[model samples]
Target: MKIGVLTIGAELLNGARIDTNSNWISKTVIDHGGMVEFNISTKDNQSSIIKALDFLLDQSIDMIIMTGGLGPTHDDITAKTLFEYFDDIPILDEKYWNFLVSRFKKKGFKVSALNKTLALKPSNGKIIDNPIGTARGLHFSSNKKEIIALPGVPSEMKSMMREATLPMIKKISQKSIHSSILRTTGITESSLYEKLFSLIKQAPDVELAFLPSLFGVDLRTSSTDNDKFSNFLMQVKILLDEFIYSDKNLELEEVVVNLLNNHNLTVATAESCTGGLIGDRITNTSGASKVFKGGIIAYSNEIKINQLGVKKETIQKFGAVSIETASEMAAGVQKLFSTDIGISSTGIAGPLGGNKDKPVGLVYIAISINGVTTVYKNNFKSNRKNNKRITSQVALNLVRKELLKF
Candidate 1:
C-alpha cells in the first residue's frame, strides 16, 4: 500500500518548527509494509490544504495521514476542512462535549465556550478517541481511499496513532514487514556509502536508507518478506563485519555495557574536555552499575593532580591535552576504582583555547584494559558540540574494539 503523509502548520512551512510528524508517519507506515510515496508540509490555509489533498487523491494513494491544526484555537481548521472535503454538515458531538467538560472540571477549571469548538466533527466522519488531548482525531473514507487526521501536538498524535490508528490499518490490510538497523562508527558517511553502493544497488528486494546524526550513521534496511529480509540482512552483515558496531538494535553505551558484562569486567572514567559526558553515557544505560564502578571530572590541572593523582611533572612537560596526561588519568582512575578497565579523555573542544601545536578539536583518549594501556589522538574539524560528540563516540568505539579483541 502507498501512503501519503501531509503535515499542516504555518510554523512548519516558515521553518519555525520542524515537521517531525512526516518522519514518524513515514517510518511507521514503512515498518508496517506500506510505502510512503510522498510527504508534504503546508500552511493552515484552507485552499492550500484542499489543493494538497486533491493532489494526493489524484495520485491514487491508498491512504493519507495528516497531522496538525486540531487545537481549540481559531487557527485549528482541519476539522472544518474535512467537513468541506466530505461535503457534510458540521455537527456538535454532545458526548465529546460532555467528555471535554468533564476533563476541564477534573482539572479544577471551568469549561469556556471556546473549548466547545473541539467537540465539533464532520458529519460523515468517525471520531478517533484522543486520550491525551482535547483534539479528537477523524477517520474518513471515500471510494476505498482512507484519510486519517490527527492533532498537531506530537505526543497526542503519537498516542492516538499507536493506540488506535495503527491497529485499524493493520486489521484492514493484514501484512507484515521486517526491518534491521546497523550502527557504525569510526568511518565517514561518504566512505561507507561508497563501499555499500554496489550491494545496495544489487539488492532490489530490500530498501536501504542512511540516517546520519551527531553520534554516527545508522544503516536501515527493510523488506516485506520476513525470511527474505533476514537473509538479506545476513548478507549485509557478512559484507560489513568489522565496521558494524551493532546488529541487534543496541546503542553504543548498551554495546559497551554488554561487552563489559560478558567479560566480567568493570570500568571507571576520568573526563576532562568532555566534562563527565563519557561517564554520563555509560551510566545512562540500564544496569550500568553492574560494570561501571565510578568516574571523576578532572577538569582542572589541580583536580587531575590531587584527585586522579596525575603527576604534576607530566602535565608540566606534555600539557593537559597530551597523551601522557590522558594515560595518567586512565591509570589513576583504574587504580582509584580498582576496576578492570579505565577510560579517559582530554581535549581542546572550542572556538578558542588552542595553540599552534595543539589546535581546537585535538583530543587524546586512553584506555587501560586488563593491565594493558593504549592511547589514541584525534584531530577533528567541526564545532564544539560536534567535537565533543565525536570524542564520546570514538571513546566508546575504542572500548568496543578492545572488547571484541578479548
Candidate 2:
C-alpha cells in the first residue's frame, strides 16, 4: 500500500507549531507494511488544501492520510474543502449529534452551535469514530483512491489511527515492511557503520539505517524478507554485542534497572555537573525503588566534601572534575547509601568557567562496585544543555555495562 500524508495548519507552516502528525502517520504506515510515498504540509486555506490534495492524487498513492484543521473553529476547513474537492455534499449525522448533545448535557454544559460542525460528514464518506474527541474522523473513497481525515490534536489523532485507520490499512496491505531497532550506546555512528559494513554487504536483502542522536546511535535493520530479517539481527548481535544495550528498543536506564533487579543489587548516584539527572533517568523507569536507593547532588566542593565524603585533599590535588575526585565521590556515595553499586559524574558542562587545562564539555564519570572504583574521561563538543544531557546518558551507559558483568 502506498500512502501520502497531508498536514494542514497555518501554525505548522509559520513555525508556530511543529507538524508532528505527518511524522507519526508516516512511521505508523511504514510499520504496518505500507509505504509513505510523500508527505506535504500546507496552510489552513481551501486553496492550499485543494492544491495539496491534487498533488497527492497525482502521485497515484493508494490512500491519503490527512491531519490538522479538523475542529469547530472557522479556520477548521478540512471537511468543507474536502467535500468540494470530491464534489460531495455535507450530510448531518443526526444520531451522532444527539449523542454529543446528551454527552454535553450529562456534563452540566449545553452543546454550542459551533460544535455541530463535527457531526457534518461528506455524503459519500464513512465516519471513523473518535472515542476521545468531539470531531469524528472521515473516510472518503472514489475512483479507487481513498482519503482518511483525522484531527490535528496529537492524542486524538493517535487514538483514531490506532483504533480504526491502521486496521483498515492492514486489511488491504499486501506487503509487510519488516523492521527492528537495535539500541546502542558508547559508540559513534561512523564507527558502528565501519564495524557492520562488511556484514551488511554480505546480506544484500537487509537494509541498515543509522539514526544518531545526542544519547546514542540506533541501528534500524529492515528487510521485506522475513527469513533474512531474523538472520541479519543475529549477525548484528554477534558483532556489536558489547555496544548494544537493548535489541528491544529499551532505554539505557531501563536496561540498567533490569540488570540491577536480576542481580538483586541496589545503586546510588553522586552528581555534580549533571546535577541529579542520572538519578532522574534511573527513577523514571517503573520499579526503580527496588534497585535505586537514592542520590545526592554534590554540585559544590563543599557538598562533595560534606555530603558525599570526597576528601578535600583529593579535590585540591586533582581538581573537582578529575578522576581522583570522581572515584572518591562514587565510593563515598556507595558507602553512604550502602548500595552494591554507586555512580558519580563530575565535569565542566558550560560555555564558561573553563580554562586551558580544563575546557568546556570535559566530564569524568565513575562507578564503584564492591569497593573497586573505575573512572572514565570523556570530552564532548556541544552546548551546555547537550553536554549535560550527553553526560547523563554516558553515566547511565556506564552503569549498564557494569551491571552486565554480574
Candidate 3:
C-alpha cells in the first residue's frame, strides 16, 4: 500500500516545534507493511492543508494519514478543511458526546464545554475513541482509498495507531516487515563494514543502515522476509561474536550490568576526566544496585592518592593521565570497594590543555579483575561531552570483554 502522511501544524513550519508525529507514523506504517511514499508538513492554515491534501489525492495514495490540528482551538482547522474538501460539513456525534460526559463524570472532573468540539465529525466518517485524550480520531474509508486523522499528541497517537490503525493496515497490506538492531562498541563502523562485507552481500534482500554516535555504532536491518532475516542475523552474530555486544540493541551499560548480575559479580569505578560518568551509566540500569558497589570521583591527583590509594609517586612520575596511574586507580577502587571488577578512566578531553606528546582527547581506560589489570589507550576527536561519552563506552566495553572470560 502506498501511503502518504501529512503533518499539519503552524509550529512545525515555523520551527517552533519538531514534527515527530510524521516520523512515528511513517515507521508505524512500514512496521505494518505499508510503504510511505511521501511525507509533507503544512501550516495549520486551511488553504495550506487543502493544498497538501490535494497533492496526496492526486498522487493516488492508497491511504492518507494526517496528524495534528485536531484540538478545540480555532487554529486547529484540519477537520473542518477535510470536511469541506469532501463537499460536506461536520455534524455533532451525539453518542460520542454522551460517552465523553459520562467518562468525565466517572473521572470526577467537570467536563469542559470546549471538549464538545471533539465530538463533531464529518457526516460520513467513523469515530475512533481516544481513551488517553479528548480528541477522537476520524476514519474515512472509500472504495479507492482510506483516510485516517489522529491526534497530534504522541502518546495519544501511538495508542490509537497500535490499538486500531495497525490492525486495519495489516489486513490491507500483503508484506510483513521486521526490524532488528545490533549494537557494538570497542570497534569502528568502517571495520564492521569491512568484516561483515561478505555476510551482508549474502543477504542481498535485507536493508541495512548504520547509525554511529558517541557511544558506538548501531547496525539497523529491516526486512520483509522473516526466514531470510533470521538466517542473516545468525550469520551476523557468528561473524562478530566478540564485537557484537548486543544483538537486541541493548545499551552497552545495560549489557554489562546484566552480564555481571548473571555472573553474581560486583563492580565499582574510579573516574578522573569522566567525573563519575561511568558510575552514572551503571546506576541508570535498573537492578544495578545488585552488582554495583560504589564509585569514587578521583578527579584530582590528591583524591586519587588519598582516597583511592593511588601512589603519589605514580602520579608524579607518569602524570595523572598515564596508564600506570589508571591501572593503579582501577586496582585501588576494586580493593577499596571490595568489588570483583573495577573500572577507571583518565583522559585529557579538551579544546585546551594539550601538548605535542599528549594531545587532547587522549583517554586511558583500565579494568581490574581481582587485582589483575589491563589498560587501553585511545584518542577521540570531538567536543568535551562526546569525548567523555566515548571514554565511558570504551571503559564499559573493556569490562564487558573481561567478563566474557568467565
Candidate 4:
C-alpha cells in the first residue's frame, strides 16, 4: 500500500523544531510493507490544512497519516479542521470522557472543560487509542481515502502508530517486505559505493540505500524477493566484513559494549579533547555497568600527569596531543582501573589552538590491552563539535575491533 504523510506544524517550517514525525512515519510505513508516496508539511492554520488535504486527496495514495495539532489549545486545530472537511459534527464519547475523568482524578488533578474536548471526535470517525496522552487519535474514511490523524508529540505518535496504525495498514497491505541495515565505520560513502558497485549491479531486485553521517555509513538493504536478497546480502557481507560493525542497526558504542560482555572483559577510559564523550557513549548502553569499570576526564596536563600518571617529560617533549602521551594515558588508566582494556583520546578539537606542526583536529587514540598499548593518529577536518564526536566514534570503533581479536 502507498501512503502519504502530512505533518502539521508552523514550528517545523519556521525551523523552531524538526519534523521527526515525518521521518519516523515514513520509515515505519516502509517497515510495515507499505510505501510512503510523499510527505507534506503545513502551517498550523485552517487554510493550509485544507489545501494540504486537497492536494493529498487528489494524489493516487492509498492512505494518509497525519500528525500534529491534536491538543487542548487554540493552535491545536487539526481535529476541528478534519471534522469540518469531512462534513461531520463533533460528538462526545461519554465512556472515554469518564475514563479521562478517572485518570485525572487518580493523578490528583481536576479535569477542566478544555480537557473534555479530547473526548469529542467526528460523528463518523473511529477513535484510535492513545495510552500515553490525553489526545486520542481519529480515523476517518471518506470517499475511499483513509485518513489517520494522530497526536504530534513523538512519544504519543509512536505509541499510536505501533498499537493502532500498523495493524490497520497490515490489513490492507498485500506485499511482504524485509530490510536489514549494516552499520560500518572508518569508511566513506564514496569508498563504500566503489567497493559495492559490482555487487549492487549484480542484484537489481534489492533496494540499497546509503545513509551517511558524522559517525559512519549505514547500508540499508531491502527487498520483496527473499531468495535474491539473501544471496546478495551474504555476498556483500563477505566483501565488507572488516568494515561492518553491526548488521542489526546497533550503534558503535552498543557494539563495543556487547563485545566486551561476550568476552567477559572490562574497560575504562581516560579522555582529553573529547572530554567524557567516549565514556558517556559506552555507558549509554544498558548493562554497561557490568563491563565499564570507570573513566577519568584528564583534560589538562596536570590531571594527566597526577591522575592518569602520564609522565610530565613525555607531555613536555611531545605535547599532550601526541601518541606518546595517549599511550601512557591508556596504560595508566588500565593499570589504575585494573581492567582488561583501557582506551584514551587526546586531540585538539578546535576552531583554535593550531599551528603548522600541530594543527587543529589532530588526534591520537590509544588502546591498552594485555600489557600492550597500540595508538592510532588522525587529522580530521571539521569544527570542534564534529571533531569531538568523530574522535569518540573512532575510539569506540578501536575498542570494538580489539575485542573482536579475542
Best by lDDT: 4
lDDT of 4: 0.92
Candidate order by lDDT, decreasing, is 4, 2, 1, 3
Residues 100-126 of candidate 2: C-alpha lDDT, one tens digit per residue: 999999999989999889989778788
The residue-level lDDT of candidate 1 at 172 comes to 64
Against the correct fold, how does model 4 do in TM-score?
A: 0.98
The parts of candidate 2 lying over 4 Å away from their true place are 106-108
Worst 10 residues of 3 by lDDT: 23-32
Q: Which candidate order results from sorting by TM-score in descending order?
A: 4, 2, 1, 3
Which candidate number would show the highest TM-score if scored against the true structure? 4
Candidate 4: residue pairs that collide = none
Each prediction's Cα RMSD?
1.9, 1.6, 2.8, 1.2
In terms of lDDT, model 1 sits at: 0.87
TM-score for candidate 1, please give it: 0.94
* lDDT tens digits, residue span 78-124, model 3: 77777777766788889989988998999998888888888897778
**What's each prediction's TM-score?**
0.94, 0.96, 0.88, 0.98
Better of 1 and 2 by lDDT: 2
Residue range 31-114, candidate 1, lDDT tens digits: 655778989888998999999999998886788889998787888888889888889787888998998899899999999998
Q: Judging by lDDT, tell me the better candidate of 1 and 4.
A: 4
